[model samples]
Target: MSVRWSFSWEDEEWLATRTPPADNNLKLAIETLIVPFGRSWQAVDNYLEVWRNMELEHGAEYSVSTPSAAVERISRDTVEIGDLYDQFEDVRLPVDEFVTLLTDLSAAMRNQ
Candidate 1:
């Protein structure tokens, strides 16, 4: 199945203020997107890794994971912050807020 990102109106407004990112910067932007949106994956890399593994094993037989799945899994103890998996939909937030929130979460996770 195909996946698409979601952006709230506030997220769109916040994104509009920033300049377009280069192709290489897409990963960073995606990471920033998921932070405050309550996604469970630690970073975008985790999401990609999940997708990669799933592709290797199932060859698209199963649906991909998404931010909604992340949130649900986080709530249910199936996944934790900083873990990566496939099947995620894009969840958008302001870059500044996302960076700050993620930084705080990362520190907390490391300390725990």
Candidate 2:
């Protein structure tokens, strides 16, 4: 699946005022993005564990075409999502874009 991020007008205004935001503003942005990102990671890990258990219990009936592929996709997405937080120092997305990224990341995790 592919996710696209978009910015809202309010986000535009907020970002416009603070390309390189004050330390406090940056901290607030990080906090806002990280909490949900962490939650999504937890949820994805739980889901993968449950899926593995179901497959173990049910054999072929519960088998997927490629279980490793699913895991890899989730891992890749998670890493990419996590990178948003990790690389925040190098990038300054608008608030709306940041929010959109978080929302999209969460959706990707849940969909998995």
Candidate 3:
């Protein structure tokens, strides 16, 4: 599954809504990470740098050898990673990758 990653740098208020007393973490993430690249490769690259540094606060962190699992993990962390519409809610234009995935999924479901 392809995942979309975005954090809007243009909107600072986005950070105030994450991780509990999330006054800083969430906003910083949105403003500096995804807003610039939107759903592009550069955007995901930025997130990967940060994600790799995270320790999850209460569990073990292990090396991820599988590309599929790594993508899933990143997608899960972005909340709306699997979403096709939200990338346009506050960010710039998105790539067609998400649109393609959703379309295929819809067709498959219809066929079922």
- Candidate that would win on lDDT: 1
In candidate 1, the residue pairs with backbone N, CA or C atoms under 3 Å apart (3 or more residues apart, or in different chains) clash, namely: 42-82, 46-84, 64-87, 65-86, 65-87, 65-88, 66-87, 66-88, 66-89, 67-89
Q: What is the overall TM-score of model 2 with all chains considered together? A: 0.27
Q: Report the candidate with higher lDDT, 1 versus 2.
A: 1
**TM-score to native of every candidate shown:** 0.28, 0.27, 0.22
Lowest lDDT sum, 10 consecutive residues, model 3, at: 63-72
Better of 1 and 3 by TM-score: 1
User: Runs in model 1 with CA error above 4 Å?
Assistant: 1-42, 69-112
User: Using TM-score as the measure, what is the rank order of every candidate, best first?
Assistant: 1, 2, 3
In candidate 2, what residue range of length 10 has the lowest lDDT sum? 64-73
Model 3: per-residue lDDT, tens digit, 4-109? 3322223332111222232343333333323333334443443444445542531233222212112123232222222223322222222243233323333332
Q: Candidate 2: which stretches are off by over 4 Å?
A: 1-3, 6-89
lDDT per residue for candidate 2 within 1-112, as digits (tens), equals: 2324322224222111223334654444434433432435464344545545754565423322122111111221121112233434422433244434545444544554
Give Cα-based local distance difference scores for all models.
0.37, 0.36, 0.31
Q: What is the lDDT of residue 66 in candidate 3?
A: 19
Give all candidate RMSDs, comma-separated. 13.2, 14.5, 14.5
